[model samples]
Target chain A: MDAPAIYRIALDVMGGDNAPVALLEGARAALQAHPELFLHLVGDEDRLRPLLAHTGLKGELASRFAIVHAASVVDMDDKATSILKEKKDSSIRVAAQLVREGKADGVVSMGHTGAAMVASKMVLGTLSGVDRPCLAAILPNMQGRPTVLLDVGANIDCRPDQIAQFAIMGSIYAEGVLGIPGPRVGVLSVGEEEGKGSTTTREAAEALKDIDLNFAGNAEGRDIWNGKFDVIACDGFVGNALLKSAEALAEGLVQGMKGVFKENLLTKLAALLTLNGLKRFAARLDYAEYGGAPLLGVKGVSIIGHGRSNAKAVHSAIRAALMASEHRVNDQIQASLGRLMSQAGSQETS
Target chain B: MDAPAIYRIALDVMGGDNAPVALLEGARAALQAHPELFLHLVGDEDRLRPLLAHTGLKGELASRFAIVHAASVVDMDDKATSILKEKKDSSIRVAAQLVREGKADGVVSMGHTGAAMVASKMVLGTLSGVDRPCLAAILPNMQGRPTVLLDVGANIDCRPDQIAQFAIMGSIYAEGVLGIPGPRVGVLSVGEEEGKGSTTTREAAEALKDIDLNFAGNAEGRDIWNGKFDVIACDGFVGNALLKSAEALAEGLVQGMKGVFKENLLTKLAALLTLNGLKRFAARLDYAEYGGAPLLGVKGVSIIGHGRSNAKAVHSAIRAALMASEHRVNDQIQASLGRLMSQAGSQETS
Candidate 1:
């Protein structure tokens, strides 16, 4: 299969709550599946060597993956500001630096979201014309495809200009990666009607309407999974809440069903018969199914996996990183942003 | 039991996508179930007569549910602003007026949400010290207990004072009505950190930290459905979006499961066996399960049901109204607001 388009994904080995083990296992899984894939495990060499030795890899497989010793690892519980200020040699910071230095195609981290965002921002910097980098999470819709929601946890207090830019980035990601045509972008608001939002949303909606993108005016939160819009735009705070709420609800429902279905003989029988369907449903809702959230608006490809990610989640995250890097999401974002700004300028003059 | 607490819930008979059919049937469901429950159906007499005839209701039900001719109905497709300005004598306005004039114990309208908000504001008025009214919805958690979220769609532009009041109202509703003891109230923000939100949120969080209630610092969107907090507060604009997104996700999951499970013959058999569990899961996530969203800052008992509500939803909404009325939500809100204002006063001085 033409060597599966070899991509080197840098992994922050000591990031998430389930650190090196999950990270090391994930790297192993990715490497086993894609023979051409290379992994740069960024962490203390001593800690990783023992874990890697257990993988029992030989020859080329071992050579393909290497540990780049980092002085420290950013703890998942550390404060974002403190981590950014103090943890320069942390695994997350070093991993991000690898992408910036052209040593890796992308960097994936299961670190504190804020820490990962901060390190990625500091090391790789935001793309030109992008003020802040937004974390875009892909939510599975009924169509079996995914919708990209931006600024899920990045910049909570955003201006209209920033949200407008977020829409552009989200649109590009959805189209460039997800393969949606002429993506419908909607600004998240209270109602679908015009002028039905905060000062920032209202202003962003006005600006978005003038842009060349397939702007669908204001969309309520219900519109996110309704397949009404391909790209849902909002300030990071709202987007983060929506993303998390959706995930939590799905997880809750799945858990609740498991409990309810096992309480009786009839339900147990039902559970057995519905097992495949339930598995499919769980897979559809599983965050691991989609891999990771892309840190859009950044200069380089950076993916943020969940804080509690296991090997499977980390593996999916690496796959997501490969996909994002292949799609050239940043290039599409910058091009779209330029078009949006020019459209706004023309509207002001006309 | 004890005359079932007579509650004259004013119904917007001609509101919603289903019009009088759903509204009329919903009123009948409540009225028939509880003999003490009376419905003041607000809409044109000419249109209502035939609709009632179709229900084949007895003379007792016909007499118990009175049709108050409002001469106009708010179309579901109409703009909120146009509905407010043009439909002066609309069912929503008249229904809200019933609560204002004490003709009805509460008003339940399944019409344009913005129109409902405006009508409730103008007719019912805000609780004495409330600067703005908030639309509060109950989001079902994994634990099966619902969490009340305020500012679902009332005031888009909110100040710190308003959000602080929302927190208080949300707390009271959660405690007094939802039956949570000293409900944990949280301000919805991007981060769990204290000083991480917009200007309004920062001020609101600071104000909330000192409240007598069990104020949990900051909850992200994921925490809303996690049942970690009894009440999650935010500006109406963001609250509405979060509420909608959560609702949409739940609805989408249910719909997706139904379609997927019923897709094949084998799956259909599985669906039948798992039907009870699915139904229970549906009920748990159903918006109608809790009845209606309460207008938090309003003086009177004002519950705004979904615009597309059916008979069961309307019935549940009426029940919600009764609960709110019994709890004296308005009085509690007023008392809470007074405390909040004084607390802010002390903070300002310090």
Candidate 2:
């Protein structure tokens, strides 16, 4: 495989639960590992400057990194519309603007997801023919490759048009950024039979079949982790609830396991003996391994992370942003959607 | 706690994957556990008689059991409407008829869910005001008690009216059968806020507020496993997908863990230490532990089990049928819906 191109990423230092410290540590770690990478740390100057100075990252490596300060910030509890209007100079906005201005190739933030998405769309704009951007998360699959679940809380009332668009964009991201040669896209439905889904979903599945890509048929929720398809598209309401439900059940069972292990001395001994292996198994199912989801159909790569992300998770998010930019995933998305338009036009004429 | 009164249940012996063996074994187990329990084994007399005799269930205990023959059967692939039209003498239909004739207090079937539901509705009829009969599953929660999730896979396009009815029925079942005192009911939504859901869900949430039951505010998917609410109601599409997704995730993780533990010598040793504890933990999250989900809103108690159910699961389903009957859950549902109707009428006149 050829070496990846050098990519510049704007990292939001004022976001997430362990904000500046996690952000700075992650940046330092990511930069040290990838000699071809460059970073622009966006946050309050006073706090970030001290953390950077304390890092003592000197010499050639230090020259590859810079900090750009923003005056305000978006709190997790802040309304999306309020953030877009009142906090124009927020860190999220500043980082997104850096990508729009070509100062950075992509933007990564572990902040309020709604605010992050709104800021990115407002500053960088959406790709032509893209009505709404959907966020895609890479979940672990048994086939050794992760599958992409899109529109997971990005848009509540996602119509058939949006679902089709999401399938195209998700497939593009899966192929370009995730390194899949050809991605199979599936529509989320209650059943796999021909007439099993709602009218809206069935229409979306029909629309997908006309596109110039591999369109897998309707998939139930169980298919998400089964590795049967690479990309699954659905309305955000169902997607969000399904994603949260899966996460909660996994976490609940793991927590319950810990409780059971602590019941008696024999179980405590068993816990000690198998603690490492159990942790390794749980880590494979952990959402933090990926840390962030990319907002597709946007003009530039924008990564939105969970607010509770720690240093390692922040590092992963920054790495994902760099990978997306290097692969030109946004360009692939535009190309695919353009081809789909032409195909539909020809079919109508015929 | 007072001992639950004996409730005679008609068990469909020709249903499910294991057929006569699982059905006979489960019936024997259930009867042995409850001294006052009685059962009517409904299937081909030839097949069931041998299985019963082989079990050595002789003397007075044998008197508690009876056999009822049905000429036809409902295959898993049978259409719901087609079954009612063509197979009136099917085992599922025969069992439901026993409930209607007052020969049995309830009915339990591990056959196709659609067939079981149709048979029960056709024979026993729906409660006076109920439009649809929704299935309810008790999901194990972190609160040490399971939460009731309704409309698992009953109606395709569940309207606001149905969601309101499900909440009333689910709450009554929780209170009477599950032994909860005034169970808190929640309307499943994308978010906890009143307006943070799809238009249909928002309307459903609004309808729930006017009901006489203890309507908890809107709940996210996380609220289900967190056990924040005793009963959660939603459209069958979302509810089925969510329940199946959670079940698949748990099963997938357990399967993955088994693969991990078998990797090498060290992991194998670790697996041995943790085997007992892990199995115990997995059992707590297993759906088969509770087994069947009942078709709520119908006049008589009807329990529905999966096609792949084993003897243990079949036993659990029969137990659930008995519990529902003994608790007078159907009466509680009728009373609750009656009160809600009167409240609405009085308020409209005022």
Candidate 3:
């Protein structure tokens, strides 16, 4: 069966809050676990070489990993336009180039989100029939399955048509990666009613209703954790902010619970007893559990991790990148986009 | 001075999922707690009259409360425009009327949010120079103090100028109600950078920078729970969706934790021990703890509660209404509006 297509992933070793070291450890761990992986560490050789040597990789596994040298850095402060022109040698840029040059099947970056997105857009370009690329996350729902939300900070201001595209891409990701068949797509709005949102959303909702997928009309914020839909399409501005806020709320509750347990002797004992249970519950809401948000609509897989990501998060991102590429998500997206666009064109002409 | 300006609140007893019974119990509880409050229950006299008598209210405390009958109903499905024109005797409309006639200082409704908001807008009208009425919620931030978020489900689409107005109203609410001397106001966006949002927010931020308030610039979703700003303003569509999403996240986490504790014998024992601690932490994130979201930019106090609110929530809503009126929040908003509008206008011309 063609040996399962050895997935070569370009690891942006110099990205994230904890670079070089965390990336080295995470890459080693991922490579150790996955036999069909060949990781190309894209970063400054001087920084990555020492960390990789010290991470205790066996000789056999080490043979599958290689380092690609490039010194330029894309700081979180680097503007997208500036990264495109000035930071050509940035790790994120080089990682994307690996995919463009056919050296890698996917790229994983935890650095400047905009920088990574811009680099991927310019280097790999977008898939067929896709205009702008977007970010999509798999959020854990109450039903024990994950819901996919797209445009999570890839574009600050989204056109109604873009939202329609998001639904298609998000739906594809759900079906291709999460194994959800014909994912129920929903438009994020203040109300479930057709006419109950901003002009952009109302227009998007109308357009979504016209699409051929399993559209769930409009969904409220409460529907997020309630597992109301398989994929929720929204503008980047709202999607990014909402996800972060929900994370903060969940974290605050966990911390507050910790504080409550520390209040007295009796509670302290209880906290120890239920520590495993609390951890299990927190695992449900942890974004790190899903690895990273995937940069969809692009030509190849690019997973964007948190700036504060640790080795565990990095490991998950690598896993996600492999899954996406192995599933041939881009090919699936290309086919789906062709069908939806033709239908949209017919509607427009009518 | 002048008998401390007694706060008389009219509550729509027929509103909410629990209806007249919850309202009767809540009104009684509020009256018992605050001798300064005089409640006028507005609903069908047939439903409210018996509930109040059966709840075991003494003759003297009962003197502080009265029932006003209103037959016309604003069904949750009823359109806002239709409710404005036809439902003249609806409880929400009647309660709002009591405020306009100076018979009550504030009105509380847990019924159809849009209908209640429309009724308040039409009956009480807006304060002088106020272009739109907005909803402001005191969300609990990680710092233990509340963060004021405005235009939450009030206006789906807001102009840049309207955002400026939201900042003014929200600022006044923080100072007049929460007693913050000069609250730091922020425009909720996708990023914390200057030019990091949509055209609407960029314009709003630019105009805000020209004004006198302590504008905290753009705040991402993380800032909501990080307690970065005391007040965050946004278009109602975004604010409502984000808030509901955060709420769902918190509730989900709480429920998830409960499930974890039910796993086995060890977890069951731990659950019993940490149950109190979990309850305490959950209360910190509870929306009902803060009562209701205030309808700011209006002439009189209007508190919008959840349809599923219990007696405690109803009681808290009444308490918030009393505090807003007692502090003369509308007067504070009126004075602040004049200053902001002139500043916004001057910026436009320049």
Candidate number of the best DockQ: 3
Which scores greater on TM-score, model 1 or model 2? 2
lDDT of 1 by residue, B1-350 (tens): 56556668788877777778887777777877777677888998898887786775557687787888898877767666554578888888888888888999888888877778778888887788888778888877877788888887777778886888888888888877778899988888877888887787889888777668798888888888888988888887788777777777777777766766776787777678777777777777777777778887786888887876877888888877777777777787788788767777887899
- TM-score on 0 to 1 scale for chain A of candidate 1: 0.90
Order of the predicted models by lDDT, top scorer first: 3, 2, 1
Residue B62 of model 2, lDDT score: 92
Give a tens-digit lDDT track for model 2, residues A232-287.
Answer: 99888888888778777777877776776687776677567666777777676666
Show where candidate 3 strays beyond 4 Å. Answer: A1-4, A50-56, A76-82, A346-350, B1-4, B53-56, B72-82, B85-87, B263-268, B342-350
Ranking by TM-score: 3, 2, 1
For B1-350, candidate 2 gives per-residue lDDT tens digits of: 99756689999989899897888888888888877789999999877777786764556679889999998789877787656778888999999999999999889999877889888887889887687889998887877677999988888777887888898888888887777888999888878877888877788788788767788878888988998999999888888888777777777877876776676776677567666777777676666767788899887889998888888888888888888887888887878777777777888899
Candidate 1 Cα outliers beyond 4 Å, as residue runs: A1-7, A32-37, A50-57, A82-86, A209-212, A310-312, A331-350, B1-7, B17-38, B46-65, B82-85, B339-350
lDDT of 2: 0.83
Give the alpha carbon lDDT tens digit for every residue of B1-350 in model 3.
57665689999998889887887888888988898999898999886677777775557887888888999768878886666778888999999999999999999999988888898888899889788889987888888778888878888889987887888888877887777878999998887878888899888888788667888899778878878899998989889988889778777776777777788887788778777766766676666777788998888899999889888989989988988888888887787778776766886799
Docking class of 3: medium
Instruction: Go through the candidates in order and give each one's DockQ.
Output: 0.61, 0.50, 0.69
Clash pairs for candidate 3: none
lDDT string for model 1 (A1-350, tens) is 45556678899988888887888888888888876578899999987787776764445688788889899876656777555678788888889888899999889999878788887888888888787788888887766677778778888789999998888888888777777989999888877779777889899888887667899898888887878888888888788778778777778876877777787887787677767877887677677777788888887889898888888999888877776777878777888787766776887899
Candidate 2 lDDT at B100 equals: 93
Assess every candidate by TM-score.
0.89, 0.92, 0.93
C-alpha local distance difference test of each model: 0.81, 0.83, 0.84
